[model samples]
Target chain A: MSESVNQQPVPLHEHGQRRPMKKRLWWIAISPSVWAIHFLACYITAAVWCEKIGEGNLRPLQISVGIYTAIALPVIIWVGYSSYRNFRRGDPPVPYDFDDPTDRTHFFGFTAFLLSSLSVVATLFTVLVFVLVGSCD
Target chain B: MNFVPSQSALDHAGVGAESIAGLFWVMLIGGCLIWLIVVGLAVYAIVVPGQHDQKRTRMLVIGGGAVFPTIVLTALLTYGLAMLPDLQRPAPEGSQVIEVAGVRWWWRIHYRMPDGNRVETANEIHLPVNEPVEFKLKSEDVIHAFWVPSLGGKVDMMPGRENRLKLHPTRVGVYRGVCAEYCGEAHTQMAFDVIVESREDYDEWLRQQASLAVAISDEAEAGRKIFAGSGCGACHSIRGTSADGVVGPDLTHFGSRRSIGASVLPNNADNLTRWIAETHRVKSGVEMPAFETLAEDELRALVRYLGELK
Candidate 1:
């Protein structure tokens, strides 16, 4: 029942039925946006601290915090910006699905299995953070 | 303030390991207790199987295994967090500070003796027994870890940044030190020794080392000429004479220091002669080239001269 990979549906007032405007915006607000803000704050604060105090002399705790924020910031920014752009432009992106354009279009319209797979990737990232935190003094 | 084990690293390392050992005992005993209880319950349930619904079997297992494990882990984690604050000791004050720098396959030591006098040595380190010693660790190129198992845990020696380790070895003994970090091919053979001596003997040793730079017998003096002319002086250093080169270990206290070839060979005349004559033979991955071209007599004389530096 999936369409070609390149198809992206524009935001419409009615899909199967009429929906409220506020409800539509709320539905469109993905979790990555929240992640972006969280990471941005963590990263900016740490980068400023590293710059001001010099990275060479960081104590173990500071080093752990700095490394985690530094790595998370760029990846979050890149993913959040790109996906948010595509969602707005009616050209939503799907990272892995090349053939089914229908698979690319969903905001909440994500594949249950694909979203489940994100849990594995997210878990791996969390594990890295765990190890980093463990190194803290 | 240096990175190497300026007494802090050594003491903390010991404390850290002891902490780990304590936690290990707790886990082993606690986990076994939980395991026995859970297994006992399971066996009791199986002895009278089907009293609960067969469909409930999976749920029971999940609850017993997964949920119980979560409880066990949380308890352990709580205990660990409670214990973590005491895991490592603070850096010691009123300690001897030694700066140890690691190169390709060797170590360079700069001992800042009391009275602000700096005695540069390599590979071999001497400390007054029972004194707390601190090491400021650095690496000239690749990453290296300063590890002396009996004294302390490993601390990485990173270039540009200083890492500190503190050690208070109570015994008057010679213990081996090794490069725990894998930099290259010669990493394993990269080793040294910590020589802990009586306070007065250590002082006497230092004075002899300081003077050996100038006072050599005639034959050793002649062999010293051979050392300089052979380009060995370019990598090695012998203070108070013309053998000043930054590429290798400081040889001013070569005879007095514990080991030769970084930590490779025993500090004796035969090893010194073999090391100088065919360095690669004794320590295969060592950075210094073999001086096999030297005449046998010249090599022996040079070894004897270096040995006398003590």
Candidate 2:
């Protein structure tokens, strides 16, 4: 059944299948993008608070950074989980089958997982900025 | 301003300097190591002609790229963050409070005492060794940075707002202070000398500055009259004389300063004469108008009078 499915000719006008293929690999970009967004959000909010609200009152800025970290971490973890699911689904019966598009999808999934792992670490680093650095003078 | 790190970060003048220097070294070493590892791996990948196992390659990427950076960055971030509060700690009790206002091309300093009285000085800042000094930094016109590299980090002086920085001078020596942020045309020549001396000497200097100028010679007296007639009082102020203008630097002890023209030139009769005659030639874009109308002798007398201000 798997060989027959692999042998089947892919349709030229089948836009639906191509979209899913691309969507499955979208996590590769989303993980790091989430990290960059979270970093900027935390930095900008802290700078605004430090300059405007006086450094003595840092609780509001601290809360905002905490919320940002909380949001970023979960999204990165979700990306990692999706990557893992896709990786398992795209596993070739014959390991290292580069000729097969399904097998190639597995490689992309693995790349997503690695990127998501790094993103999770980067998000934690951003959280560390709030934890370590003072919000104000 | 010169890009040279104000003084060697290795001097470890204060907590801020020490911590920053430590961080710099750590980053430098760690970065080099990381770069070498990455390059080595790339070289190995290029040179080695073999069919690599895909699963193993993925594992290697995860281990080397993600895991390595996370571990290293986590350690560095923790170490750096821990040093922040200590570097910004408030000055100790009995520490001196100096209000420094950053003008276009000079510094207006007010030494605030414990008794609520304030002593005003300009261009040069004198500090007592080993005493934690709190600088109340502000700007009259544009943003400026107060940086005495040997003491601590640079702090921005923003107009319409007050920022504070604490510096504890460990050594009794003169350090060059350059305005780290660019303000205007004369910013390059905008420099100040920070003299760190014993507490007794600093106190003595303040006391001397509080009084009027000492007795001027008959020759210097002629110069003072020329200064008065030239409408110098409209901009510059000499504490012991009738000249009291807030538009420019207070020349109360101008003669005693080591450098003039905002540390642009050595404080001497010739430099002062040239500075007064053509202010624009000495320091471009200065607020003080040139006094080219004054005769050569009159200019000399004015320079002589200012030299006796101490």
Candidate 3:
């Protein structure tokens, strides 16, 4: 069993054509980065609207945060789907327990998929606030 | 443990407080249920004699850790956020409006009467049960929060901006209110009594508060003379008297209050004397000066006079 696991081919990335470590890490981090940007945009929009426009109208805030959620969710879902595909690439899918190059790539894919899933939920939760709170008060 | 219950948010007496307490119970019970399931799974995995496959283990971890928490937390968020609109809804037109200014270490309350006149009171608040009252909260100096935990949620009293809170007391009982936000050295001492009474009783109390302070006895009459002679009128106001100062609490109905010195002491002759003679010792950093220079007889007379203002 150990010999067969060691003999598995590196199917995703070719030997010399592999991407740099930094670029690969960026792919892992992009999901949470999108979440962070969405979070800040929602907060700044609410703060400015409350401070400058005063209370009684939440239409603008709801529309702006809705737009941000729409933009963030699709990107996160795509990233998560791609990561899931990468994570399941091996002949005997997941538990990615081996110490080979292919297994390491699979582990990274698993981590990115988990992060993307979390970001999608978090972005939804942020949008939930705008929907529930009707005014600055 | 002491038998008497301390101040708690769960001791809900009003509509808003009831909703808050409900949310707290739901969250607490939901969290405990989730904790039990997660811990039960871990205990079973550790103690059970079985060879669990990686696929089953992965499913257990993902289902227990991520999916469960996300669903539970999102449900809780939705339930909690749904309460905000009703809690923040403004009182209807022609509601009884009370303007409460958070002064240094005290509360300055003004009731807008039906005929457009304002009646001023301090340290204590009275409300009619089952009637929604609009409180226009403000701060004279630093930031303060008006929190009657049993009545409603706390709202910050900013210096320039006015924040509003609506409270409809369901029970007729005395509840304690405190400055939830720390402001100064005597922050902890800033407390007041919230008396929820019948509509007729509330109206009667407000009527008495709007009236003038009359000196009924010779001792009270003599004490009034001393209060005027000693310049106590500079920062204090006793309506229908020469003391028209707006710098301190109105003393027109001081004797009728539940507690003296912002609920620091029980309203009585001895506590009033101590508070008047050694104001700083009773509550440090208070803006009121201690009347240490007054003679013993004069102080007694002054206490007599203030005690009779009811």
* Candidate 1 C-alpha lDDT tens digits along B188-211: 878877676788988887677556
Task: Write the number of the candidate with greater TM-score, choosing between 1 and 2.
Answer: 2
Q: Which candidate leads the pack in lDDT?
A: 3
Best by TM-score: 3
Ranking by lDDT: 3, 2, 1
For candidate 3, lDDT tens digit of each residue in B150-242?
Answer: 899999999998999999889888888999999999999998888888999988998888888865699988899998998889988999999
**Which residues of candidate 1, in runs, are more than 4 Å off?**
A1-137, B1-17, B20-65, B71-90, B127-132, B170-172, B196-214
CA error at residue A43 for candidate 1, angstroms: 8.9
lDDT of 2 by residue, B1-310 (tens): 1222234556655556666778889988877877877777778778989977888877767667766766776787788788778778778877899999999999998998778888777888888888888999999999999888777888999999999998887777776788999999999888888887889999998888777778898878998888888888988888777899998988888888988888888889989888878789999999899888998888887888789888
Give the alpha-carbon lDDT of every model: 0.63, 0.80, 0.86
True contacts kept of 3: 0.76
Clashing pairs for predicted structure model 3, backbone only: none
C-alpha TM-score for every candidate: 0.63, 0.82, 0.88
Comparing 2 and 3 on TM-score, the stronger one: 3
Model 3 chain B: weakest 10-residue lDDT segment is B1-10
Q: Residue-wise lDDT of candidate 3 within A1-137, one digit each (tens)?
A: 37765456665555434341212656889899999999999999899988888567788789889898889999999989887776666554557766676766677778899999989988988888888877786
DockQ (CA atoms), all models:
0.07, 0.50, 0.65
Interface RMSD of 3: 1.0
